[model samples]
Target: MSKITTLPLGFANALLVRDKGAILVDTGINANKKIYEELFRELDFNPRNINLIVVTHGHADHFANANELKEITGAPVLCHKEAVYALQTAGNSAIVPRNELGKSVFEIIKKNLPRSTKKVNPDIIVDSSFDLHPYGVAGKVVYTPGHTDCSLSIILESGDAIVGDMLVPSFFTGEPCVAYFANNEKALFASLQMVLQQASIFYGGHGGPFTKAEVLDLL
Candidate 1:
């Protein structure tokens, strides 16, 4: 069995998936080392034991502290090929509003829509499914773009998936729904359906480890 722990940050969460070693997915907005150090102590995990760091996408909220964490844990950073430019430039992919709330929120934070982080070139840049067994887990990072062209999801053999921003809950209602900002809703729905077909639970950066039933209703 694998253990998925939510490492809460200010506005989002960085997930720690423990199997033989551990895999960290996402690093919240501008997260610092002290936060993770404290979190590691609380979890009773060695800070240096992170075998891999998977940035679910090129969003600042997800990849912000990746470089810092890599320096601390000595873990290899992996991202999709499409995310390379954003990661290398310390930039983020665009956020295209898909709903009324999205439009409102985007307007409020339009200037900082795609937040910035310190540049960190990924060790592995894959355009196709990448197996995680080499990193001490039975999982795969598959392309699942919609929220962003570079979006990716990690699907574990244990029926748990870490989807970046592909599935977001409403800011007002907190109900599971499609992404507020997506490059293509049709593609997003297809990807969501694909993931739901395989994994029983979905973990998103902003919200939850929602059950399949909850997500199915969104579809």
Candidate 2:
């Protein structure tokens, strides 16, 4: 059985999936490394045991520490092919607002968050669905887009999915909602539908482990 653990890094979250080895989904921000290290220790997982680091999107909060984690774990980093440019340029990848909330959030992020320091070159660039069996997980990485043009989701055979910002829990109500910031609303809806067909439990960067029923109601 695969063990899934949610590693909440303050404002964002990362997932640690353990099968025969470990697969880390997202790396949070640069400053969250110590927190991740501590969590790994608590879970009795050695950083060296990590076989792969998957970045769900190119957002600073999601891929900021990917290179660092890869260095520490001696694991290769993987991301959608389209995200490579953003990661290499340390750019925000041109986020387009989908709603009033998205606009407000984007402005706040622009004002507060700094660009990621180091440029990350993905070791494996995926254009379509990629199997994870070689990495010791019974899952695959699927292009899910919408939260960003290169968003990807990790869907496990057990029906749990690590869907970055495509869906998030409301900060105030903790209800499942489409992400506060999305580049394309229509694409986000379609990606959510695609994920819904494959996953029963939805995990998000902001909050979740939401049921399929809860997500359906939110949609």
Candidate 3:
């Protein structure tokens, strides 16, 4: 069985998947390098034990420290092909709001967030689904494009999905629902439907660990 550990980094989060080897999902911001090191030590995991680093999307908050992590772990960085531009250029993708909250959040992200300085060229560029067996994990990286053109989610064999910004737990009510911002609402819904068919438990970049039933009720 794979163990998933959520490392909350300020406003963002990162996931550490441990099986025969370690797989890190997302890298938080550039300043998170020390946080990663501290967590690795607390978890009793050597940095060298990490075999792969998977960035769920091109967002700075999610992938800003990937380059540093690759250096520390000596692992290949993997991301969707479309994410190359944003990753290499250190630019953010345009966000489309889905509701009033989304609109407010989008404004804050646009106006306040600084562009990440870290630049990374993915070692593995996934076009669709990429199996994780070769990397010693019991899961696969599936393209879940809605939050961004390059958003990807990791679906574990145990039916847990690490969905980055695809869905978020509501701040006020803590209810599971579609994310506030998406690149395309229609595509986001389609991606959510696809995920529902495969995953029983949903983990989000914001707040979650929501059951399939909870998500279904929101939908």
Q: How many backbone clashes does every candidate have?
A: 0, 0, 0
Best model per lDDT:
1
Q: Which residue pairs in candidate 2 have backbone atoms (N, alpha carbon, C) closer than 3 angstroms, thus clashing?
A: none
Q: Which has the greatest TM-score?
A: 1
Per-residue lDDT tens digits for candidate 1, residues 1-219, read 677898878677899988987889988774688878888999889968789999888878888878789988999999988898888888878778988988987888777564655888899898979988888888989999888888899999999999998877777788877799898888888889889988999999988889998987877
Please state every model's RMSD to the true fold in angstroms.
1.2, 1.7, 1.5
User: Candidate 1: which stretches are off by over 4 Å?
Assistant: none
lDDT of each: 0.86, 0.83, 0.84
Off by over 4 Å in 2: 30-33
Candidate 3 has what TM-score?
A: 0.94
Per-residue lDDT tens digits for candidate 3, residues 177-215, read: 688888788889899999999999888776778889888
Q: For residues 70-146, what per-residue lDDT tens digits would candidate 2 score against the true structure?
A: 77789999989889998888776667767776676667777776467788888999988999999999999999978
Better of 2 and 3 by TM-score: 3
Model 3 CA deviation exceeding 4 Å by range = 171-174
Clashes of 1: 0
Q: What is the TM-score of each candidate against the true structure?
A: 0.96, 0.93, 0.94
